[model samples]
Every structure is written in structure tokens, then in C-alpha cells.
Target: MNIDKPHAGNKFFLSEISFLGYVVTRGGLRPDLQKVDAVRDAPTPTSLTHVRAFLGFASYYRRFIKGFAAIARPLTNLLRKDQPLTCDGECERTFSTLKEALASAPILVRPDHGKPFILITEWQSEAISAILAQQGKDGREHVVEYASRTIPDERKNDSAPQGECYAVVWGIQHFHPYLYGQKFLLVTDHEPLLALKKLTNYTGMIGRWAVRLQEYDFDIVDRKAEKHGNADGLTRLHRPGKVPKGEEITSWKEPKQSEGLEYGQVAILPRT
Candidate 1:
């Protein structure tokens, strides 16, 4: 094949480009050295305001910091209402750890829309978290993005299964800009979600969630809880809603078939 192009100021091929504090290269996206150095050289915070400032700056690169929420918990806790402003030893260590993590942050590759994405999600009483990643040509998963947030106090007491179910919906919606018209794989440690379509008596909330999920194209898979350490740590600080023992899901049954609609199938597989 032969290709020809007129010399143009805005159409020349280049090895890489810096955009939004990230360096986009042929291999992947990496944090800009200048930005990384700025965070690395930031002074220790003595006030809550300072702490928040630091966090706001560092957060832009949180995708490079695995277990980011867990690592920054000590610092974030100080921001709660009526909490003391003291920067304890733990907070100091967290600051240093965050700086170090940013300095050595991984380069996340731009996802190939043609490839299937793997979404990992976790749920705790106060938080829902997820990681968007994809398997590389080298057969290793590469990070694409990470998202997490605290649930409101009012809804914090939702049942464990419901919370898990919400994690699925929230994660997919969070990444809707990328997932809206694509097929991907959803991975979760919560078995209940994988079996959601099989539940004979689904809750109102679950029913609503299932309906919303129908718009997307994807597959759900169940993995062992122990293997989901990436998204797990983001929600570790929150207490988990408990499920009593012996509560077997005897109502498991296939979801009803809808005319003109095909539900995404759940695929159960052994751990690699």
C-alpha cells in the first residue's frame, strides 16, 4: 500500500503529544514529568485546606496510584465535620506515600475501542468503586481509569446485595462515555450480582437497575473476592453491609425474556 499526504501544519504525524498534563505516546499515556515533579516537591500540609489542595492536585493522577482511596484515607479522614485538624504521623506518611506513588506512576495505555474492556468494581457501606482496564497484546491487564466515591449517609444502610448491585450500575454509568456503544466484560467479586438475572424475587431497586443496565452491551463475570484487590482497597475504609449466614438464594431462576430485548449474559470462569 502507498500513502500520500500534502504537507500541512496541523496534519503532520508525530511520535507523541502532551495534553491535559499527560504525555500521549505510541506505547501509552504517562504523567508529564513537570507535573509529577511538582507534586513530588509539594510541601507537607499543616492545615485541612492544605491537605485538600494537595489531594486535589495529586488526584489527577490517581489512576496511576492503585488502592488510592485506602492510601489517602488517613488524610481524607481529617476533613470530616468536627474532626481535628492535626496532621498526625499517619497523615504525614500518607502524604509521602502519595507523592512517591505519583512519582512512579504507571503509564496507562489508551484503550482500543475495538478490544473488550474489563471492569472491576467493589462496594462497601459508604463507597462504590471501579477500575476500567483492558488486556494488552502482551496478555496483561493495563489500567485505563479508576473511579470511586462515598455513598450518602441516607443510602449507606442499603442491603449488602443491593449495594453490590448498585456498584455494577454505578460503575457502568460512570464510564458511559466509553461504554455506551461498546461491548465489554464486567468483573465483580460479589456473586449476587452475577446471579441477579436469576433471582426470582428481585427488589424494586434491583428491578430498576436491571432495566437501566439493559441499554448497554456487555458480559458480567464472577471472580473470587480475594482476587479483586485493586478495586477492593478503594472501598476498604467503609464498613461492609452484612449478609446473615444461611441466607441461601433459593429463588434463583432465569430472568424473563423481553420482546425485542436481549440481556447481556453472565459468564462464570475459573481464576487465571
Candidate 2:
């Protein structure tokens, strides 16, 4: 390791250092104070170039923002082809929100390999999001990372339930390196996931997703939607149009249980 200020001094010690727009301390990693202030104090972007520059700077610390992609959607849209460069009301609001989110961003800790993780997901008609957190020694959950994205045009027509399932699959895959070998709890408000392992009649995307999920070690637990605030906030922020209508799947019922193993646990699935 190369140390700065390598003068004739015998040794130098420092408590912490700021590197690449992040502060490193014994406690955890946090966005550098100066960078946070820069984002907060930045003027509302007036053109596409300005928007992109601000986004480029802000994107560096996006993991600190709970739903960054959703929050910045309006501003990003300005950069799309044929879109106007003007900062509309939505764009201004998004810019402000991003600054606020960054200014108040939390200090995230390194993932402790010894501890188990918790994965929570949310899905709406427009976007899907997930949060990875772990219980700290103080018994409170701390966020490891957040992920969210707008639904592409090809999937805009998926039902809400399917979207939820998609969120799970996407979330798991996004954090696969963190979760591959560990046992983690998968929490969601969607009840269909509780019966996911036993459903024999699922078709299309949901079926393919379920098959893929069987390879992971996890337990699916249902939590009230209100409790999933982080991911819920992400999905709700960037909904762009009227939700897909008449795509509801009303026939999925809770599967009957067999033996001690419930359908929600990760167990060997019969080959399709």
C-alpha cells in the first residue's frame, strides 16, 4: 500500500480517510461529506448535458439512495432521443429529491459473512425493487444495498402478482454473489409466493422463474406490504403510465401442505 506524504517521518497514522467520494471509517462506508454537499447545493439542471453531468456525479453514490433509479427517472427521461432538454416540474422535483436522498444517506456496513441476510422485494406495474439488509449487533436491520429499475416496454403488461414474483427473481439474481450459499429469508407481501413451490399449473414467466428459484436456499415469508417501505417506495416513485388492466390472475390459491415441509421452504422440486 502506498501512503501519501511519505516524508522522512518514521510513521504516520490516521483514524479514517476519504477515498473516491466515500468515507471509510471503522463503523462503515458513507458518502463523502463534501460530495453530499455538492449534490445538495447543485442548481437544478437546465439542459440535457447538465442533467447527465449531475446524474453522473450522483450515480456514484446511488446505493445510498433507497430508490435512486426511480427517483431519477424524470430527469433521465430528458436525455432520451427526441425528448426536450427543458427541466419540467417533474424533472425539478426529481432533482431535488435526489439531492435530499443523498444528503440523508445512511452509512452502510460491509456484509458480515458470518451473519444471515434478509431480502425484501416490491413490485408495481411500472417498476420492481429490492433491498438487502442484515440484523446488526444492536438488533436493528441495516441496509446493504438497494436495487430498482423501470419495467421495460416488453413487460409493461405483466400482472401485479407476476410482477411481484419477478421482483423476487430479479432481486435474488442481482445479489446472487451475496446470497448464493447462505440461507436467507425472502420476504414479500404477495401471498402467491407461499404456495410457489407446489403450484403445478403455473405457466409462462412465473413458471420459468419458479424453476430457477428452486436452486437457491431460502425461505419465503409473507410480510405486510406496509412493512416493506424501502422497496415499496422505489416502485411507487416511477410509475409512468396507466397500469396494465385486466391482467389479473385470480385463480392462484394456497397449496395444500404435505408432510412437515411447507411449500414456501427451499426444497427439492420435482423436475418439470
Best by TM-score: 2
lDDT of 1 by residue, 64-110 (tens): 77767767877777667555434556777898999898888888888
TM-score for each candidate, following the candidate numbering: 0.73, 0.78
Question: What lDDT score goes with residue 74 in model 1?
Answer: 74
The superposed Cα distance between candidate 2 and the true structure at residue 4, in angstroms, equals: 15
For each candidate, what is the lDDT?
0.72, 0.73
Best by lDDT: 2
Clashes within 3 Å, all models in order: 1, 0
- Clash pairs, candidate 1, are 198-253
lDDT of 2 by residue, 1-272 (tens): 44564657444466677887889877788988887776677665433345566888877787787777778877777666555333445666788888888888898887887999999998877678889999998998888888888787787888877878888998999999999988998989998788877768657888888888888889889988778787781122212132234211122233456633222121222222
Ten-residue region with minimum lDDT total, candidate 1: 260-269
